[model samples]
Target: MAADRLALALAVTIRHDGNGGVADDLTAPEGLTDWVRELAEPLRDALDAEDFTADTAALDAVRELRAAVRALFARAVRPGPPSSADAHRLLPEDQAMARLNAAAARAPGAPRLEWPDGGAPVVRAARPPGFTDADRLVAALARDAIGFLAGPERERLRACPAPRCVRYFVKDHPRQEWCKPSCGNRARVARHHRRHRTES
Candidate 1:
């Protein structure tokens, strides 16, 4: 399945609770490690290479980053221009700018022209030798999220229409209004019930 880039990064922090609700999953270090492993390939490789072990300090740092990213995504999908001021409110102004700057600097580049097959090459960002694996992973994810947010797919990003569902998804077609068919059906059923109650 095609990966949902920004959504995947944001998803590490929260997930559907067994009782049909969302709950925080990044409350501990192991949860953070599990979340890192589930990320897309390039990002996963960076984390794996470092033999990075999650600890409470790293967990806290990542959570702060996640909060900034989530806030950015929420604003991106809104009707108007996303506020830079609002972004700074969720994260330290310098940290927010640094993440965005790092993302811009490392956004994926074109495939190598010297590949034997003359086909799409496996593009990997060149990290300096001194950079730790954990640094690469965090940078990769932040870049992924920024690239996705700034690209045309931003138009397709939508918050799920179901009243109780907090997830976001990309609209697959012009008429697609909900994150999934179940959400669409739930919305329709709710509207039907509302109409019946008003008429009765």
Candidate 2:
């Protein structure tokens, strides 16, 4: 996945549970393991092994990073309302930035060049020695979040306004409004109901 997409993926891990409540995908070690495995392609550079597992500490660390990322995401969507799940509970902007930077610093990486036969040269982030898997994971996520926030995609970020939804998405087109088609439909239905209630 690309940097912007990876950051968005992490942000969307906290979303509606489809039953009028928010759900956290990274609430458990198993969920964290599954999430990492699912995004293994984009996270390949950060992971030291294929069979990575999460412990309590790793889960807690990643959750803290996610909160920071979400807070920054909310800030990125400036003037717009944040996701309803934790809108009132988001960390202060400065604190969030500090936490994210600290996480990224835990696993500092340098760029490395690679060239293959008859192929163009490519640059990849080379992980330094002695960092734990958790450090790498959190750092990778923080780095991606930083990249997304500083990149062009930050302008397109928006929080879904549909009822019971709490997701942030990058608008794909000029006319796009909600995070997904379902959210759009739900928002429209909610509007209709509100209109009906007022008329009654």
Candidate 3:
């Protein structure tokens, strides 16, 4: 679910340009940071992570990651697992994992043992030695994307079938097709019109 959430967040960055065109938020660092931060907030809240500011370098990393996340979701909605070539084209597994690990290495925390009242000691994440807040945010997203692709939830991801919508979403139930009800209605109407045309 978290992965789907992440996928949805990334997908939203690709906006419809009103003339059946698409716009990428990654074109500018400012826009990228805004979009990533908008989504990252939920992600941070989920982890109870401290807020992170996206720098130029962090923007570049997240934009690259966005491509990988997009490609994975696109592949998931297709008939089978993406071919090795296709998968590698967007984000090579080794490369993505390595980047993720690199970002994580810079995460602002070290594992420390914490003792709670009447509770056994538990290891908690503390600020790491030299990582910035942005590193942690980007790392968290990378980890989510990897887990989602590898986990069973990938099976439930779907792309909207609306005429001009390019969003991918998790299917809430069986018999679901389009990403939202409006898309489903549009699909139904299109199918109905096709049947009528054939009959006529």
Deviation (Å) of 12 in candidate 2: 0.9
lDDT of each: 0.60, 0.89, 0.63
Task: Arrange candidates, best TM-score first.
Answer: 2, 1, 3
Residue 114 error, candidate 3, Å: 7.1
Between which residue pairs do clashes occur in model 1? none
lDDT of 1 at 51: 54
Tens digits of per-residue lDDT for model 2, 27-137: 999999998888887888888536889999999999999999999998988899999889999999999999999998889898899899999998888978798899999
For model 1, state the Cα shift of residue 40 in Å: 5.3
What's model 3's overall lDDT? 0.63
Q: Give the distance in Å from residue 6's predicted Cα in candidate 1 to where it truly belongs.
A: 4.3
| lDDT (C-alpha) at residue 133 in model 2 | 91
Whichever of 1 and 3 has more lDDT, that candidate is 3
> Would you list the clashing residue pairs of candidate 3?
108-127, 108-128, 109-126, 109-127, 109-128
For residues 1-200, what per-residue lDDT tens digits would candidate 1 score against the true structure? 14546444453355444365667878898877776666545464344633566788667666666666666666667773332323234565456657655643433333333345857656544445665554555566666677776788778776665645556667778998776677788789999999999999
Task: Tell me the tens digit of each residue's lDDT in model 3 across 1-200.
Answer: 24436756765576544466666776766775566556645564324333444568867877776766766576677873332223445666456556655654555455677899999997755645465556666666666676777788788887666666666677778988766787677677878999999999
Better of 2 and 3 by lDDT: 2
1 versus 2: better TM-score goes to: 2
| Candidate number that wins on lDDT, 1 or 2 | 2
